[model samples]
Structure formats: structure tokens, C-alpha cells
Target chain A: MDWQKLISFITVLVTLFLIVRSEIKKYKLRKTRPCGSDCNCAVLKEVSLKKLK
Target chain B: MNYFAIIGNPNCGKTTIFNELTGLRQKVGNYPGVTVEKKEGKILFKDGTEITLLDLPGTYSLTANSPDEKIVSDILLRKRIDIQRPEGIVCVVDASNLERNLYLVSQIIDQRFPLIIVLNMVDVAEDTGLIIDVGKLSKLLGVSVIKTVGIKRKGIDELKRAIQGKFQVSTAVRQWKLPEIVREEHEELTQLLIKHNSVKEDVAVYDAAALLSSPKQLKEFKDELKPEILDHVLLDHQRLESLGYDRHSIFVKSRIEWVRSICSEVVSIGEKKKSYTDIIDSIATHKFWGYIIFLTLMILMFQSIFTWATIPMNFISKGFDWIGYQLGALIPHGDLHDLIILGAVRGVGAVVTFLPQILLLFLFLGVLEDTGYMARAAFIMDRLMNKVGLHGKAFIPMLSSFACAIPGIMATRTIENPRDRLVTMMVAPLMSCSARLPVYSLLIAAFIPNLLVFGFWNLQGIVMISLYMLGLVMALLMAFIFKKTILKGKTPDFIMELPPYRLPSLKNILIQMWERSVLFLKKAGTIILGVSIILWFLATYPKIENGNPSEKLAHSFIGQAGQFIEPLMKPLGFDWKIDISILSSLLQREVFVSSISTIYNIQNADDKTVSLKSQMQKDLDTSTGLPRFTILTAICIMVYYVLAMQCMSTLTVVKRETNSWKWPFFQFAYMTGLAYLVTFIVYRVGLSFI
Candidate 1:
């Protein structure tokens, strides 16, 4: 076939693959890393105040 | 309605006010084709008026040293800038941190921008028992004042009314202009100010002092000033420098005083209560426990991405193979049938297959950043960052690369030191971003078994983690090496402002995620679409349909092409089939899968029963009459994709970020060379066994 059509077809196929791949990955994810980890990765800054004399 | 450019120090609630004004509708995208994200949105007035609000990067002053700070100066100047010149600017000041934030606002006043004083974070002010008279402060600064809690979306309508009335009403009362006393102090040394340029004759003294403080700027003004009066201006500036009012101090003191008075008047402090942010930060920044918690969070992100992303990937594989069959059935057994099944559909499917992981990675990163945890992550890494000759602030960009290198590279602009900035930019791309995950996943899935490594962990997962760690360690090593050798310079001293910890607004977080996802689809999608089409063509075309068709096309142009390269790659455990796959992989590394699938499918016309994976395991090489899963071939493929310059999108990013082809060209060359050498070693070593 012509180069243009081949390119067009590949574009469509890649899109389909990406969509399907994402969905499948999502489906598998439910089986792993169930979100409630006790790891407190949230960051914050601390300021120490001096006591009044 | 008048436009208001909400300007403040980087972490001083400027973005929060912008978010509050726009309400989850702002568009975040690359500035034109550049990587710098330009934020623009509008705020509607109470009287149905609309004022466009620009949220420029936070800067200490308009002296404009870095590109980010330059943006603040450029917008305020409205000269040679691409965006609209704001009619007025609502300077957002954290009442608690008035000195630094007001440093920018006072500079804005000199630019002669219409002014609205937005005393943000008044809640914090109130908690501290700080009382400020808003009306009196407004009179002192010659502008209107509005108190706002950007996170809670409070005092918004009042802000809107102020913006709407800015053009019609004159807020100019007490001028923040430099006192004649300060100017006279300089004049005692010489009449340099009047002699230098006709421009400064009517200009504010604050502007003149700011220019003199900058060494390069002082020289530039001296050189540019009319030669006839240069001596007087130089003499005057020297005299002014002696007066305890050097330009920077005078400038700083002026804004500090203005902000201090304004904050004291209207804000009232009540009982001191613990902030939600502080409570959470204590754990996140625990001296010892913080690191452990951070490690666990990281492991979760990686593990979840792989296990979660693989399911849809399988469905995608099956669906594409099925479509190939259906198209093969319809095309009357001609070249078109082959083209549809093998060339177009398969080519696109290979690249498209990885979208799920990319989207999920972006979504997770978006939440991390919006929640303020990401900044805290930088804070935690700062002590470590200093050892590597980078500021704690530089770690923010490095961490940002885990989601993608493009944004991470753009973020390096925050590094003030020119040497450190360039070093960060060069090594950032080495980080194994989410885009590289598919290559790692496919290789490990295909070659590495589910065997336990070191008794407990999965060997495949361990290998995957190793590759990522290797990249990071290399980046650090390279930065150290560059600092000592190529970029020999003293590392700049570190001074980073730690923003207050706040529970990130969920409304704002979701909006950021949506904007990023849409931008990825719009910008990266277009380029990927183009590349996908081109790759598909290289796999198809020049078909042979005549008698002895297999024999006729066996030695066709592509075969001959592959044949020429076959001997060269044989040491790496690659035959022509592997060579062709590598060639077709130019668009992206993952295309390696579909490329092999298409080639093998054409050879086995009994393609009805076997899946793509099955076909690969079953296909026999004529030379050996055995399956093609040679130990050498697997190693070669893995190493090649691991370091190769396979993604045009990456090169596109490099070009845009550096604003030149020189950097991207060097990037492609170095990475490809590194990939070739690494793959060669792996393939040759594997071949020794087979």
C-alpha cells in the first residue's frame, strides 16, 4: 500500500492500543496497591517560636 | 472592568487568588510552543464586568534577573510583551510575610500600574492577633484594599468590584515614590541623576535607585546615558551610595514599611490555633520517620502503575490482532489486506497501547503537586540535595521528572545559578519517566520470569526498580562530575523559602489534573499521530502479489535493507527480523512489539488460531529452525530500548526547552551511542551462552 495510508492506519491502531492498554492496566490495578497505606508522604514546614522572656 | 495582574512572591498565594478568581477554569499550557506554562483566566465583576487576571511567576523584585522573574517585569512593562498589559494589578501579600511579598508590590507601584492591595491569608493574620486598618493603609498607598482568603474563596466579590471600578476610580493618594530626601542624598555627591538621561528627569526615584543597585545594570545605564552628562550622574549615584540608603536597602525598606502599616490596620488577631497544615507537616517532615514513609509511598506509585496498567494493555493487544484478521478477511487477499492488517492498524496500536500508563502517571503527579506534598518532598530532599551541589529547590525539578522530563526540564529555570541550572537541565532527561515504563514492562514480562530474587522479591520487579535507580544515580554522578570538571564553578549558596503547609484545595487539585491531561492530549497527541502514520508506512508498501509471491518479496527492498544490517547486528543476537523491528521502532520503543507481530503474521498465514504472543513463541527461524527467543536477541532488544533515542516527542521537548536544535541533536547522538554500546555488550554476552 501507499505510505500515507500505512501511516494513517498505524495512527488509528496506536490510539486503540493506548486506550485498551490504559483500561487493562486500570483493571489490573484494582488487584494491587489498594490505596490506604499508612505512609504519610505529605510534606509541611515547621516553625519553632521562642518563649517570651 | 480593569485587568489585574495578581503579583506576589512565589509562594505568597498568588496562584491561590488566581484560582479563586477563575474557579477551576484556567487553562494551563506551554507558552506558545515553549515549555513554560502560561496561565491566563478571567474574573467576572459583580456588575457583569470582566477583567482578565494574569498570574505571573513570583519574584522578589522587577529587577528581572531570571527568565521567570523577567516575565513579571515584562508583563508589568507591557513593552514587547506578547500578552495584554494589565490595566491594574492586585498585589497579593501574605500579611504574615509582608516584607518579602511587598518588595514586589512596591516595585509594581513604580511601574505605575493601577493598584489594588489584596491582603491575602488574613486568617493567619487574625490568628496571630495582628490588626490592620484597611482604609488607612489604602490611603497611605494611594490605592483600594481588599482582604481575601484565596483558599476559602472568601472576599472574592469585593475583589471583583475593586477590579471593575479600578479604571473609573482613582486610587492614587499617598505615593510609594522615593522621597526627595533620598534623592537629595544622592544629589549631594553629584548631579549624576539629571546628567545621565533625559528619561530619569520625570521618573520615580525608586526606579532610579533600583537600576543603580544592579552592577551590570549600573554599567549599562552609565554607558547608555548621554555622554555630555555622564560624570554628574556617576558622581551623584556615588554620593547616594554613601548615605545609608544604597538602592537595594532603600527599595526594600520602602515596601516593608508600606506593607507593615497596611497589614497592622485592617487585620485583627484572635486566639492562636494550630493550623491543619502544621499538624500534617510534623509527620511528613519527621527527622527519621519521614524518609521511610517517603520510600514506601514511592514503591506504591511504581507497583501500582505496573500492575494496574497491564490489564487494559492485554485487551488492546487482543483487539488489534482480531481487527487484523477481520481486515485480512475483507480485503480480497491483495496488498490492501496486508497493509490494513500489518501496516496501519498494528503500527498505531503499538504506540497507542501505552496511553493508559501515561495518563495515570500524570493524574497521580497532579494530585501530589496540588496537595502541597510535592513541595514538602523537595523540602525533605533539600539536606541531601546540598551534598550533591544542588539547592533543595533544585530537587523539585528532579522529582518532577518522574512524571515526565519535559516539565521537569522547564522547572530547572527556578535554579538561580547559571551553572547549576544548566547541569540540572542536562541530567534531568536521564531520569526514567513514566514514558519509559512500557519498554521496561514489555521486556521484563517477555524475558524475566516470576522467579524470586534474594528469596522474597519478584526478580522482574527488582530488575525494573534497578533500572530506574541506576538512571538516578547516574544523573547525580554526572552532576558531580560536571561540577568538578566541565562546569567548574563554585556552587551558589542556598536560600529557599519554605511555604506554609496547607491542605491543598481539592477543587484546585482536580482542575490542575484536568488541565494537564487535556494539554497532553492536545500537544503530544498531534505529534504522535503524525509519527505513527510514518512508522506504519515503513512496515507496509512495495508488496509482491505475483506468482511465487513469498519468493518474490523475500528479497524485496526492505529485506535487502535488513540483510545489509543483519551481519552487523548478529553479534548482538539480532537477525534481519530484529533489525527491521529496531528500524520501525524510531517512533517509539514499544513499537518493537507490533513490528515483530506484523512480520511474523505475514509468514504464518495459518494466523487464525494463534495469538500474537503464541505466534512469537512458535515462529521458527529458517537458519536454526527453532523459536526466535534467543537469549541474545532478548538482551539486545531490552538494552536498545532502554537507552535509545526512540521517541520524537522527547527530541521535540528538548528542542523546545533549549530553544535550539543543537541540544536535541547532541541528546539524540549521546543517548543512541550509549544505547548501542550497552546493547552490544548484552547481546554479545548472551550469544556466548547460546
Candidate 2:
């Protein structure tokens, strides 16, 4: 492949990797703390988890 | 590092003081419930000592009525296993409303934490012709008192010095004496808790009193206490109530009486004069004029979003076009060049042009919030909210949803009733968050004309506000349905404090605008860019070497998927490309604009100068040989976006807030079903008129 094509291929690969990683992180965060990324009400999270269980 | 927590009643400027001390802009609005969760920042002292400062949500008392308020008592009582109790507490109170503000301080004194009282907003107090004897008040409270104007950074150094000094637990005696029988019951319960639950002696008293006052707290200790002990506590609660002593209000009443007595001793009235806040409030909160003024402000804000943002948007649009041209020339004619210009530049540029609109919206919201007008807006909205069977407190969360639904969902923690909170969460996403701004702006700017209405209002601006009002009306309608059918309950009384108005801090407003703008840019660079690249790939291959661009795209992977979905969307006047955009935007609403841009950029690869709006304007359906996006189509799409549950993040937050997958799934089904039904009706009705 040409140099430019090689760079484009690598860029696309990296973008895919980053998107997947972000999705996984968001999923795990949702499991533990459902208040989204903006809040840190861990007490509520615990109570919620206990209630869920 | 030593830890300190700043706690106070809502709107008393705990966040303002926290921001001033830590130099972090943690969103200090003049309305209550601005900080719905705990935010922590480190303050570096002069001697290289760093103290971790936590800004907790505001609460009225330690009795802990709502989930947000419960977080305060949980931390202070050391009930949560995750967070350690702070070494000292900074009890921030509004100097202008000391008598009411000190009720929480009295509760804190009973906890016996090393404390400092920040008499914030002293200027507001003085403007009302009240002088406070800080020294005498300090002696009476038996804690160090520091007077401060948090917004101006006045007395910050003194406050910091006091925080860094050796801390002492307040030696102030509990001034409010419990009645003889209530004291007996409280002491008895305290000993029982210490003996049975292994609770610490210091906190056991507070816990027992809380449990006796609010039997709901017994659920927290259910695992620790035996059934007999729980039954004993329940019996004491019943005995107090039977004796005609309101178990709930006795402590609150006594504390208020003590705070009033202290205020009488330490506060002196200088002159009886009407403040500016009063004069403005006469009309600002007047039942008739308030609605008129609010509607006028809404019109002006929506008008400015269009009028003020045009120049900057055009510049940004042209800048991206220039960059795309330059890059297209620099790279050889190949797939790499196509990817760079089509995938990255055009796609991201399509969304970035809306930055000016987003910034203007945040700026207006910041000014309204900073000047305390937002609270009045809530007050004005209360009667209507109650009529729809929602708590007046739900108004703040709904207003917050205009920025984004995530924080809006989180802000529902301040609603004490679960059913009311759930109903609010279900409808908050229908408020047309900033993510949908691109879709609305794109469609309206392309199809809606900018004629003068009644010799003043722009037709485009009116359409824009109408779209917003449509979302709001649908949200209220849904809330009403939910209240009357599934989530039926009596609307509780709405009691909100109307804060005195002050001049908005320009620096704070600018910081808010800057922060929101950066967040938008980040999303453009990350999610939008990623989706654009992927869409470009899907449309590019498998390649047809001898085919025209349209012929090539028609058989591409994205084309196949779009064509598959096109049949389902045909009734709504959407073609395959619009179907693809709709499906992609489920990840996030703004992705719809970028998806359309990417798709169009590939279709018109030969034409480099046409903007997305113009391309959309020229697009035609092959079967009918007519323009694909008529004004009716634009209106239908805009209506669909206003009601659609298209954001994954909002769904995830709903799942978390409601603590069930059932609610989020139900929300998705209902909102999407509503969107489809409404858009179908509008489209069919418009067709009949034509």
C-alpha cells in the first residue's frame, strides 16, 4: 500500500479501537453507577444495587 | 491529606465558596439544587499542605427527606462505607437569611464536628439594611465565623486561613431543650441503639432521634437491629404521636425557635427600605405580568439564537470548506484524499457550525440562572406544574434538560417522592436538549423562510420557538397522562425560596459558555468523527470501479442497510439516506446531521463547493422527480426529533436512575411510538392540504 493509504488504514483502526473502549467503559460504569458521568452519589448507587439484588 | 466538606442550604453559595477556594468552576447558579451530587477538589495551602475539599449537595436539615439530602446525613453520620467522615466541616450560611439558614448549623453542632461558619453573601445582607455582629455570633455559636462575599472573592484569604488553622469541635451547647417526655424517649432509644446495634455513643443519639422522627429511617438499620429493638423504637414513635406531640415537627420547631432567639440577639435592623429585588419582584412575580414577561424573554432568547449566531456560523462553515479544499489539493487523487475531506472535514464541520447556537443558549441560561431569575421561573411554573400533577421542584430538572438529559435525570434526586421523580425522568428527554439543536436548526434554516412576522418577529425564529414549545407541550402532556394513569398521586405543595436578585457575574457566565462549548467540540472531535469515518467506509466499499458515485453508493453496505429500512420510513416521507441518518442518530441525536453530511458528501463527491444545507435542498426523489425534502418533510422530521427517544446516553441514565431496565425499555417504546404516530399524522395531514 502507499504511505497515505497506510496512514488512513491505521487511523481508522485506532478510531474503531477507541470507540469500542469507550463503549465498554460506559457499560461498566452503567452497571456500577447509573447516575451517568456527571454525578458521584455513591450512596445512592449502593442503595440502588441493594434494592436491585 | 485532611478532608473538609462544605455543606449548606441550597442557593446559599456553598458551590460559589467551593469554587472560589479551589479555583474550580463547579457550576454555581443562583437557583437551588444546582449541585445535586458531591464534587471534590483539592485546595493547596501556602505551606504545601493540600486539603481535599468536598462540595456536597444542599439540604435544609439533617433529617434528610430526599435522596440528595440523604447523601448529606449519610456522609456526616459516617453511614456510608465508601467515604470517610471529614475531619472538619465548613458550614456555609447566607447572611441575608441567617435565622432560617442557622437551623442546619444547629443540627451540625449536635453532631460535634470541628466546624467553621462561612457567613457568605454578607453584601446582600448589608444591602437590606441589616448589620450582623459576627464576633458576638461566633461567641454564641462557639465556632469561628468568617464573613465572605463568595462571588467577589472577598474575605477568601481569611476563610482559607481559618480552614488551615487548628480545628476545634464546637463547644456550643444544644440550646433547644426537648420536652421532658420526648427527652426520656430519645435517651432510651439512644441507649438501646448503642447496646443492640453497636452504634457509637456520639452518633447513636442523633440516629435514635432521627429514627424516632422519621420511621422511614428504620429501613436503613433493618439489617443491624433486631426485630425487638425495631419494635421498641416504633412504640416510642407511636407514644410521642399519641401524646399529641408531633414527632416530626417537635425538633424542627424547637430548633427554629432557638435560631430566632439568636437572630434577635445578634441581628440589628438599620433602616426599613425597599430593596431593588423587592421592586423588581413586584412585577417579576406578579401573577399576570410574570407570564407575559416570561413569554417575551423566551421569544427574545430564541430570536437571538438565530440572529446572533449567523455570522459566526457562516465563518466556521466557510473555514471548513477552505480547509477541505486545501487538503483535497494537497493529497493525491485517491481513497486517502476522499477519506480526509469527506469523512473528517465535512462531517465534523457540519456539526461544528452549530457551536455558536449552543454557546448562545448556554449564555442565556447562565445569565437567567446567575441573576436568580430561574427561581422565579420555577415559581411561575409551579401552578402549571401542579395542575399537571408534578412537583414544582421538577421544574428545575426540566429546565436543566434543555442543556442535556443526563444531568437533568440526576437532578431528579432532589424530588423526595419516588413516583413523582420517576414521572419527571420519563419526560425530561422530550425537552429538546442541545444535541437536537443541530437537527432543528438545519431543517428550519434550510426550509423555513425568514420573513418578518407582524413587522417584528422573524418567521424562522417563531418556527424555532414553536418547535421548542411543541416539545414542552408534549412533555407536559405525557407527564399528565403518566400522573393520571400509571403514576397517579396527589401533587404535593410547592414551596420554593425566591432568592434576591443580583447582577450576574460576567466571568462566571463566560466560564459556563466556554465549558459547554468545549464539551460540544469534544463530542464533535470524538463521537462525530468516529461515526463519520465509519459511515464513509460503509458507503465507499465494496467499490464499483466503473460506476458513477450514485451507482457506487447504491450498492454499498450502508446503502443496503438504508434500503432495508427505507420501507419502514417511507410513510414519514423519508428516503433511504434519511433512514440511515435516523438509525445512526440513535447513538446520539447530533450524529444525525453528521450522518446526512457524510452521506451527501459521498453522493456529491464531484461538487466540492455546495454546503450540506444546499445539497439537502437540491436532493430529489428519483421515483417522483420532485424535491425530496419539502417544507412539510422538514416539519415532520423536526417534530419526530422533538419526541423521539433517540439518545442512548439518556436511556442509560434512565435505567440507572430508575434502577430497572424495565423503565428505560418502556420509555423507549413509548417515546418512539409517540414520535412515529405524531409524525405520521402530521405528514399525512400536510399531504392532504397540498
In model 2 chain B, where is the ten-residue run with the lowest total lDDT?
B166-175
- State the local distance difference test value for candidate 2: 0.88
lDDT of 1 by residue, B603-634 (tens): 55445556555565565676678877753466
Query: What's the TM-score of chain B for every model shown?
Result: 0.82, 0.97
Q: List the residue pairs that clash in candidate 2.
A: none
CAPRI tier for the interface of model 2: acceptable
TM-score of each: 0.78, 0.96
- Fraction of true inter-chain Cα contacts (below 8 Å) kept per model? 0.00, 0.32
